[model samples]
Target: MQKSRLLMKFQSSGHTTAVLRAMSYASPSSKLKDMTSGIEFYDKITYIEEHFEEEKDVLVQKL
Candidate 1:
Protein backbone atom coordinates (compact mmCIF):
# COMPACT_ATOMS: atom_id res chain seq x y z
CA MET A 1 0.00 0.00 0.00
CA GLN A 2 3.01 2.24 0.42
CA LYS A 3 4.21 4.33 -2.52
CA SER A 4 7.53 2.50 -2.94
CA ARG A 5 5.82 -0.88 -2.85
CA LEU A 6 3.28 0.26 -5.43
CA LEU A 7 6.03 1.57 -7.66
CA MET A 8 7.99 -1.68 -7.34
CA LYS A 9 4.95 -3.73 -8.28
CA PHE A 10 4.38 -1.58 -11.34
CA GLN A 11 8.03 -1.90 -12.34
CA SER A 12 8.07 -5.66 -11.83
CA SER A 13 4.99 -5.99 -14.05
CA GLY A 14 6.67 -3.97 -16.81
CA HIS A 15 4.13 -1.18 -16.41
CA THR A 16 6.68 1.51 -15.77
CA THR A 17 5.76 3.39 -18.95
CA ALA A 18 2.08 3.32 -18.11
CA VAL A 19 2.80 4.44 -14.56
CA LEU A 20 4.92 7.32 -15.82
CA ARG A 21 2.17 8.38 -18.22
CA ALA A 22 -0.44 8.33 -15.51
CA MET A 23 1.79 10.30 -13.15
CA SER A 24 2.46 12.87 -15.84
CA TYR A 25 -1.26 13.61 -16.07
CA ALA A 26 -1.95 13.43 -12.35
CA SER A 27 -2.66 16.68 -10.51
CA PRO A 28 -1.54 17.59 -7.02
CA SER A 29 -3.91 16.53 -4.23
CA SER A 30 -6.20 19.17 -2.74
CA LYS A 31 -4.39 18.83 0.56
CA LEU A 32 -1.09 19.63 -1.14
CA LYS A 33 -2.64 22.57 -2.95
CA ASP A 34 -4.10 23.95 0.26
CA MET A 35 -0.74 23.65 2.07
CA THR A 36 1.30 25.50 -0.53
CA SER A 37 1.70 29.29 -0.29
CA GLY A 38 4.25 31.87 -1.35
CA ILE A 39 7.38 30.56 -3.16
CA GLU A 40 7.29 27.13 -4.81
CA PHE A 41 9.92 24.34 -4.54
CA TYR A 42 12.18 25.47 -7.38
CA ASP A 43 11.70 29.10 -6.43
CA LYS A 44 12.84 28.32 -2.90
CA ILE A 45 15.93 26.54 -4.26
CA THR A 46 16.79 29.51 -6.45
CA TYR A 47 16.21 31.91 -3.57
CA ILE A 48 18.66 30.00 -1.37
CA GLU A 49 21.21 29.73 -4.20
CA GLU A 50 21.03 33.47 -4.79
CA HIS A 51 21.36 34.21 -1.09
CA PHE A 52 24.47 32.01 -0.87
CA GLU A 53 25.94 33.67 -3.96
CA GLU A 54 25.47 37.10 -2.38
CA GLU A 55 27.13 35.95 0.84
CA LYS A 56 30.03 34.42 -1.12
CA ASP A 57 30.56 37.66 -3.03
CA VAL A 58 30.60 39.64 0.21
CA LEU A 59 33.10 37.20 1.73
CA VAL A 60 35.34 37.40 -1.35
CA GLN A 61 35.25 41.18 -1.25
CA LYS A 62 36.33 41.16 2.38
CA LEU A 63 39.25 38.79 1.76
Candidate 2:
Protein backbone atom coordinates (compact mmCIF):
# COMPACT_ATOMS: atom_id res chain seq x y z
CA MET A 1 0.00 0.00 0.00
CA GLN A 2 2.83 2.42 0.80
CA LYS A 3 4.57 1.74 -2.51
CA SER A 4 1.36 2.25 -4.51
CA ARG A 5 0.59 5.41 -2.61
CA LEU A 6 4.04 6.74 -3.39
CA LEU A 7 3.54 5.96 -7.06
CA MET A 8 0.18 7.65 -7.10
CA LYS A 9 1.68 10.82 -5.66
CA PHE A 10 3.17 11.70 -9.06
CA GLN A 11 -0.17 11.38 -10.82
CA SER A 12 0.38 13.63 -13.81
CA SER A 13 2.22 12.45 -16.93
CA GLY A 14 3.63 14.57 -19.75
CA HIS A 15 0.35 14.21 -21.69
CA THR A 16 -1.59 15.43 -18.67
CA THR A 17 0.70 18.44 -18.35
CA ALA A 18 0.28 19.23 -22.04
CA VAL A 19 -3.50 19.08 -21.73
CA LEU A 20 -3.47 21.33 -18.67
CA ARG A 21 -1.26 23.82 -20.46
CA ALA A 22 -3.52 23.88 -23.50
CA MET A 23 -6.61 24.39 -21.40
CA SER A 24 -4.92 27.14 -19.39
CA TYR A 25 -3.95 29.00 -22.56
CA ALA A 26 -7.49 29.09 -23.98
CA SER A 27 -10.39 31.22 -22.74
CA PRO A 28 -12.67 29.07 -20.58
CA SER A 29 -15.77 30.43 -22.29
CA SER A 30 -14.44 29.11 -25.58
CA LYS A 31 -14.08 25.66 -24.08
CA LEU A 32 -17.66 25.77 -22.84
CA LYS A 33 -18.82 27.03 -26.22
CA ASP A 34 -17.16 24.04 -27.90
CA MET A 35 -19.19 21.65 -25.79
CA THR A 36 -22.44 23.63 -26.11
CA SER A 37 -22.48 24.15 -29.86
CA GLY A 38 -25.56 22.03 -30.47
CA ILE A 39 -28.77 24.03 -30.89
CA GLU A 40 -30.71 22.11 -28.24
CA PHE A 41 -27.98 22.70 -25.63
CA TYR A 42 -27.03 26.24 -26.56
CA ASP A 43 -29.96 27.94 -24.84
CA LYS A 44 -29.51 25.95 -21.62
CA ILE A 45 -25.79 26.61 -21.60
CA THR A 46 -26.33 30.34 -22.18
CA TYR A 47 -28.88 30.53 -19.36
CA ILE A 48 -26.48 28.94 -16.91
CA GLU A 49 -23.67 31.14 -18.20
CA GLU A 50 -25.80 34.24 -17.65
CA HIS A 51 -26.32 33.25 -14.03
CA PHE A 52 -22.58 32.84 -13.61
CA GLU A 53 -21.99 36.24 -15.15
CA GLU A 54 -24.58 37.83 -12.88
CA GLU A 55 -22.99 36.31 -9.79
CA LYS A 56 -19.58 37.48 -10.93
CA ASP A 57 -20.91 41.01 -11.43
CA VAL A 58 -22.42 41.03 -7.94
CA LEU A 59 -19.17 39.88 -6.38
CA VAL A 60 -17.21 42.47 -8.31
CA GLN A 61 -19.62 45.17 -7.22
CA LYS A 62 -19.16 44.18 -3.59
CA LEU A 63 -15.43 44.46 -3.93
Which tens-of-lDDT digit does each residue in 1-63 have in candidate 2?
433332343253545434543564486764554344322244444454568766777657766
Which pairs of residues collide in model 2? Answer: none
lDDT of each: 0.45, 0.46
lDDT of 1 at 8: 58
| Candidate 1 per-residue C-alpha lDDT over 15-55 given as tens digits, one digit per residue, 9 for 90 to 100 | 54344434444656532432232123234434545687667
Off by over 4 Å in 1: 1-39, 53-63
Model 1 is weakest, by summed lDDT over 10 consecutive residues, at: 33-42
Poorest 10 consecutive residues by lDDT, candidate 2:
1-10
Candidate 1, lDDT over the whole model: 0.45
TM-score of 1: 0.25
Model 2 spans > 4 angstroms off? 1-12, 27-63
